[model samples]
Target: MNVRHLIPTAAVAGAVVLGLTALSACSTSDAADRRPGDKLNVVASFYPMQFLAEEIGGTHVSVSTLTKPGVEPHDLELSPRQIGGLGDADYILYLKGIQPAVDDAIKLSESTHSVDAAKLTTLEDHGTETGGDEHGHEHEGEGAGADPHIWLDPVKYAEVAKGVGASLEKTDPGHAADYRKNTDALVKKLDTLNTAYKTGLRNTATKTFITTHSAFGYLAERYGLVQEGIAGIDPEAEPSPARIQEIHTIAEKSKATTVFFETLASDKTAKTVATDTGLRTDVLDPLEGITDKSKGDNYFEVMQSNLAALQKALGAK
Candidate 1:
């Protein structure tokens, strides 16, 4: 997928504002001078979230990313100006724990007018709904209970897109109809993609697979697949020696074809596991950032790539 093809010129225009000088100014007053009809001020935590907001908000919204491209969302620290952007935003979309600085800024921005996409979308409690117990919690380690990467899963992202549209409509009620229409269209696209995954991955030759982290809980639960990971909720957490040994044993016993790692985190541990088990390593992007090699510009292409990877890994036709 060509990213340039997926992104509209308007989306590219929005990204133009994210230069070093703009990021350096990070002042609320600077954002305030831009004028109201110029665009609805919106801030998204990372790439996927930013893309969704841009898709739904369209020309009516001017979207900015709180976390810069190529920067790890888990390790992001916000500048005072970035925090001011959140305070000035009509809506701020972010995964709860993926960027602690964003989360903290949202708390502070609440004193003014701003929307919290996570709470508005009710994504924080997904584990319980799916019969999974891996609830998000705060930790000093990399993005605990905040699996801010939920947008990687198409199904979850559809819901988030819907929430973003609804929130935008609320903030700018004049454009509510357009927002709803755009959101509905995007949701239909997501549904089609979801069906493709269900048909492509269900009842495949391989049922068990290993990942570097536990980020796929929503996707696994959505498709009746199982993913065992070397680490826990936090990708930064190292597996216990016993846990690593257990994963190795499981992979050997299950004849797992490949071990998957993500783009945002280090692959050293995953490489070690693959070497120990003699399994091939494959990428399963968490959609945290857009790499030069990424198929397309936004989350949809990344998700399609993920499905293709899974099908290959699972030995599906």
Candidate 2:
């Protein structure tokens, strides 16, 4: 199935924000009334969550994403309509702590069944050298406590898929067998993807890679590679002068071929690092969202492209 990436205009964004305010004061009885549809109504937090919902739920589900394409997920603020209309959907699948506003809104929402994917995997602290202070903690958000880029690791993503499938089964027991079958198929594909990454990155000349942010920790960990980020887990956070200097030093020491930036975030830091270290720059997407700027349409294609970039940068045989 071809998934068309949605981009909301400024007017729509305003409406959503306004809807949130309206929801606080108004009744949502009008919104809660379900329309006739056999497909389960699923609202995903972002691209990765949306992918899992669609893949696991298949034609039995009608999936939508809260975060639009090309927008950074961390900066998302729920519209009043989105907040007020939570009960209109059957389930809301999200990665907890990644979006604080979403977390706050979800807590207030009593209507939708919220499924957090973060619980499906173990989290690790990939805190920056400058992450101990108050400013650092705020900048890191969910990332300060633990890295939330679990979806980058195929095995962990498959685990999340399993959990989501279980939720779907519980919610729609009549389709339990279908959900199980679809989940198994999705897991098989993810396993193949895992093998592809392992084989492609195997015995690279260098194990150390540089990225704009520390979002690739899980991916690097999966493939036995070392990740050096210009910024912390939060892409919006600025690296201090000391941290920048340290990154440059590490780049020189590791002989990193390319400094990588993500599609959704600024490439300024990565470009600056590249300029300082005399290295090239390229994209290594975290699969947060899909935009026209993305090299591929969906998760699998983009991940394969990422694998190729890693192989080139690491000088894989």
Candidate 3:
């Protein structure tokens, strides 16, 4: 998380270019660009937040994301310009514990309209089983800071959507009606998604699924399935031999058929576990960010693809 110390002094210009490339890569407006508009400048922490802002704020807001597309968000280190650019935002939306740099930068910025999505929805510690690097770990004294991946759960995400809508209404009162309408539409879509997952996964041959990243805890719990993570919370962390053996036992006992991995993270762990267990490997995207490699573009499409993957893995009848 100490990104500043590692910033290379020799590649300042290259880093700037890389940063510019990142800014362009997400295909969102830059918060720092001086624009002649009354549109609210909304800076999002990442795709999940960005999606909500775009869906809810509509034409009233110009949204930008700190974490670029295709990049894993946990290790996201903000450039100095990106950090300073936070002050230019009319409203900022972020989840507190996921990105350390964004959290620190937002706290230091003078943006009063910043909204923490975690505050809008209740967070549950799905524990380390389905946890990943940032969202799934237990904090020392902070009471299991709850999983920051609430956006993965449609119901929970709907809650965050309502909160975001209200916040935007408060920020830009002139567009309150539009924000409310958009929020309702999004929530309705989420409701339909929730129903689909419920019906699709209700009668599965297995209730347990194995995964390399523990990013699907909420989704699993929501659909009455169990998640066995090869690596707890941190995707880069290697599984201990005992843990690997335990997964093998669990996979067999629970009749698990697939070892799932994310689009952004390395699939080696998933493949290794699947190969050893004689189970198939499949993509069960956590829906962190959309990329060319993603099953579908945007949240709803990717989530539908996720539902299909889960149904296939669990052998839904």
Candidate 4:
């Protein structure tokens, strides 16, 4: 993807206002890499992007996330302070179309280096429902756009990780070799993860799983399974009566045993499906962010937990 350095009008206005307000906050020693010993200030939009930067930039970069733990990234609205902070980032790492506010902030800020992870690989539409199911509701502004949960597929994530490492190399050329080495290590780990998922989900009795949202399209597709979601791409979108009926029909036909909900999203819809049918309910986290309810601290651990949940729910022998 091309680097975006153009600031929109709104971003320009916000920056001017913030610049005036914070004129006395600190001296001109306000560059992203000001202090000689300071790490590269890498501003990431949310958890996945932050994790990638930390993994590749490891020790060489200081990564900060805009969305705090336990928060939903899609609904994030940046404060003026956060917007100003973007200006101080040596590099901005984000997936375009996942968070609109962050996209606008990147456009508005004059940050020297910015990476859009979405550009690293192809994004499939993976329409919310299939096989004669009714059209489910999507987020208002996100109609029919490509799914943003590419990180769920380890292969795709590894590709994005490589792109991030390349960006870091460009931004910090002195440590280019380190970035490349770290990128290779991260890709190897992701390849191992891909192998685990393939082996674990290969012999499942059924190839279908139900969920509160369509966040697992890439994962399911990668592992030869199908995802039946109550809602469309957006988890916050309420499932209509027709949509619920569709999912019920799918679950019964596929003999799906569980309705999976994610950590950051409410389980009410999944539970409702479980209640209507005789299926159980379980957590199939999307790993949008780290939360108190998350089974592990980082992306890899949570993904492994998710694999275990899928294996049980899919009745793998």
Candidate 3: residue 268 lDDT (0-100) = 82
> What TM-score, over all chains together, does every model reach?
0.79, 0.84, 0.85, 0.87
lDDT of 1 at 30: 28
Worst 10 residues of 2 by lDDT: 129-138
Task: Report per-prediction Cα RMSD to one decimal.
Answer: 8.3, 6.3, 6.2, 4.8
lDDT of 1 by residue, 87-168 (tens): 4566677766555555555664452445555664444434322223222322122232333446656777788788888877
Q: Global lDDT for candidate 2?
A: 0.76
* Cα error of candidate 4 at position 211, Å: 0.9
Would you list the clashing residue pairs of candidate 2? Answer: 16-79, 16-80, 19-80, 19-81, 20-80, 20-81
Cα lDDT over the full model 3: 0.77
Off by over 4 Å in 1: 1-37, 120-148, 233-240
Ranking by lDDT: 4, 3, 2, 1
Candidate 1 accuracy as lDDT: 0.67
Give the top-scoring candidate (lDDT).
4
The candidate maximizing TM-score is: 4
Each candidate's clash count: 4, 6, 4, 0
